[model samples]
Target: MENKEIARVLWETADLMEIAGEDSFRIRSYRNSATSIEGYPERIIDILKDENRKVTEIPGIGKRLASVLQEIVDRGSCERRDELLKKFPPTALEFLKIQGLGPKGIALIFEHHQITTMDELEQLCKDEKLRLLPRMGAKLEEKVLRSIAQYKMRTGRFLLSFAHEAAEELKKYLAETGGVEEITAAGSLRRGKETVGDLDLLVTGPNATEVLERFVAYPRVHEILGRGANKASAKVGREGLQVDVRALPRESYGAAMQYFTGSKEHNVAVRTRAVKMGFKLSEYGLFRADNDTRVAGESEQEVYDALGLAWIPPELRENSGEIEAAGEGRLPELIELKHIRGDIHMHTTETDGRASLEEMAEAAKNLGYEYVAITDHSKAIAMANGLDETRAVAFARQVRELNRQDRGIRIFSGLECDILKDGALDLANDALAELDLVIGSVHSHMNLEPAEMTDRLLRALECPSLRVLGHPTGRLLMQREPFSFDFDRVVMEAVKRGVHFEINASPERLDLNGNLVRSAKQRGAKFTVSTDAHHPKHLHNMWYGVVTARRGWLGPADVLNTLPAERFRNAIRHN
Candidate 1:
């Protein structure tokens, strides 16, 4: 078949399996392969005809799948895949992307009522056809229609951080209207949640009428949701971009900002703490006056100080022990990106990476990293151009010679060894021991039951040569949830075994998310935040990982890789 035909088939198959609720990893392989084919610079068939052709060397195509791909290319179809694709049409795949509509849910809606396309699906949902189906009701139908309308209007939502940019744009417009004095973002956007539901803006202005008029007339204002004297809300663009503006007096600005910026739980706790301390907390400001005399205002810290506590970071202000820690003066001095002395996980051309060993080392030097661990893929993950012993030994020699050069950065020979189903490392211990750091990871076998999966992971952690576990949860955000595992117990076992956990910095896979990173830190497990970068551009993913670490309240001393070069080497050697 033609390349486009093959790509279409693969995409449809993956979508069908998604509707079937098949194992995510297995489903992901097909999706990744489809993406690879679609984006590949060379034609798939042309690449297949070369003598040196090895499809398995592609980043997303593993050995077994590569062979299957060859068969599909030769025969113009995969009989098995075609049979599966018949269950779900390509047109219906669009419905699955809507919020609250998983593949199984879509399949159920389609199966019961023969819903086949987005328009049909939307009408059925709006007309309450889904309510007549099992396990669905009027409320569910309304939610489905709303979600469908949203998806139809928007490509996707913005990341939580990006919401600040949108809020700032609207704020600046309102500020220039000659009535507003101060503006800020509130709600989950301010608290650093990964994804925001909508953007919320609060402004203190002199004239409510003028400010409201200006907001409604703004160039980007697509639709006005509501407008009142004290508050006005609107949606911008097809993405449902929301901006909320509130008018407040100068006296109440600080308190209002703090209250609105808080996670509701955090606000409740703070207010309770204030009441117990014989003060009242509100949007106007913290006050001790029973007869309306001012006590604290002008600054958020002063308000917190009046209640007797240090300021807590927005990321940790989830009412998750942050207030108590502040009261006890035990808030961790969170680590900064500058403190990272070395990177223990990275990729080079020995695998599917875009850079060679020398190039990666020089890049590390430029970044001021004291050391770079060149952990290319191990043999078990052939799709990543996983190295065999012969090639690995040669690469080791190359890295060693490079290390001896006059470069300022130290280079550590390393491999991201895949953990097999039988709880064995992809490379032998002796082979791994020759390296400075060995990162054990699960690249497959996501279908294992929770108990079995936990055991498999624990066994991999027990490897003496294994120094770090990479992306232990195996989740792909928004696209897929992590595989089933008792992460608490996993953290406990990792701590007990003296193995390190990795915060994979690949933007697509900031694996050990901030909350879990904090949880693991509290359990005595050391961490190394590395980019797991496959290309030069990906090295910056470390910044996201750092923010995640800070969210977990980790300090410089808590990260193993932030040690001085000598100490970092010693830690590796000792482990």
Candidate 2:
């Protein structure tokens, strides 16, 4: 089975067991195993093939979990998952997808009201029956109604991060099949859309039949939708997300990739240009329209050159004025992952993080980062075990001691301080002055009027200790909407105050999204693309932030954390 499919099954089992009131340790074991499997760089099947390999070597996979994974690889399903499904109505799982609902919430509604489906839950909310249940109110009922609407709008789409994970595993599996020469993921994933409905994979090889056979027999294939000599389609996992693979001869690889990796609008624009240039363009190859003579098709650059333009990065192939820029030889030298020098917003066990301060620092060093900031939560976010003045000061002392060891990476003591309802900071100025940097954020009162929200942020910007704004809009994709506010005014005030905004790299919260980043950039504002990591493994998420910045047309000069250690410290001090 693919790693994502295995991970999905394990996570679903965890959710079901949680609702079943299983032992907390067992539930946590499943959760941890799921996380480890999802983030693992290689397929478990490949790992298990080594003669000396032991599944116990995986961080969270003990003997029992390894057996379960092995069973999934041998068959397409697991016994534990099937057992749990038998105890609940088949439709019960669907309710968990609704926002404002968790395993506990679903169990409560099911036991009390026998609600098993989204339709029944929506009816209860509309009839005002949900408000009579425990912990349910009129406001929550309204929120549920809105959440259902949003959920329906987002149905059939997977998060970009999830799609990328699946694509990576599938690509690796296919590449090792011996006959595959080149394989590339196409479709919305190549375009870097925030969410995608399905995946398109294009392959070129000498043995087309061998590639097609291996693709159809992939262990994660839940069902084969169709098959042919050179193409096949299959549905994968419980979500029934379709994946289509097409094998092509080597000569037409580039043209097919360009055709499949398209925004319809961008493809139309390119074809129009081809026509104007007295040529024809198709997945077969570029050709002379008058006599069907082939021109260029061996490479992507050749395809672009046939139309008299430079090669455009896949992220910019959205028909959003990228063609005009390329025609003028003005395409941006987009930022790459290697250009990042530091991660400026992260946490440790002092707040809610799972790793220790030292572990987080060592992980940053492993990533070749010159510096990392420990921006734990401040006192306003009590749920995260946020630090108060005394704890904050003590934490600074610990950081100082660690830095004194010359650990090969600079550690900056910082706090993700909360901006309170009245625009005051959660930490006192005396406490803030003890830290090397500060990241101001909003943790509550997210439903204020637009003017109030704008004023709240503007007032926070006035504080001399505030250096960066974290998750500026407070958005969680597919679950919560960004709180209403005057974003333009917020950006303007941030620019005037010399406060940097963050591109938070957590998968669920890529806040200050691409458009806002571009808007801030156009207005001469600087930014920091940070992971906002709470665990050592999460440090690798920095690449997601870098991609978001590239989509916004940002370069190395637009990012503050790219500076060297001394210069970065000076920049933060001056701000």
Q: Per-residue lDDT for 209-255 in model 2, tens only?
A: 57767888887788998989878889876677788889888777888
Predicted candidate 1: what Cα RMSD to the true structure?
Answer: 10.6
The candidate that achieves the highest TM-score relative to the unseen native structure: 2
Off by over 4 Å in 1: 1-158, 161-184, 202-221, 227-232, 236-238, 245-251, 348-350, 354-367
Model 2 segments more than 4 A misplaced: 1-14, 17-84, 102-105, 108-116, 123-141
Residue range with the least summed lDDT across 10 consecutive positions in model 1 = 153-162
Clashing pairs in 1: none
Q: Candidate 1's residue-wise lDDT over 1-575, tens digit each? A: 45555677677777878887788998889988986776565777877788798777678988866766777888756765666667766666677777677777787876787756788988887777778977778887887777776666544456554565577667787778786666777777776666566876777757645777888898667889999888888887535677777877777777777788888899999999988877888888887746655667666777888888898777778899999999999998988899998777888877888778778777877888898889999898888779877766776787778778768889888888899997888887767777778889888988689999989998998889888998888876554457898888988988887788888776566788778888888889888899887766567667767877887788888788999877887887734
Clashing residue pairs, backbone N/CA/C < 3 A, model 2: none
Error of 1 at 172 (Å): 8.1
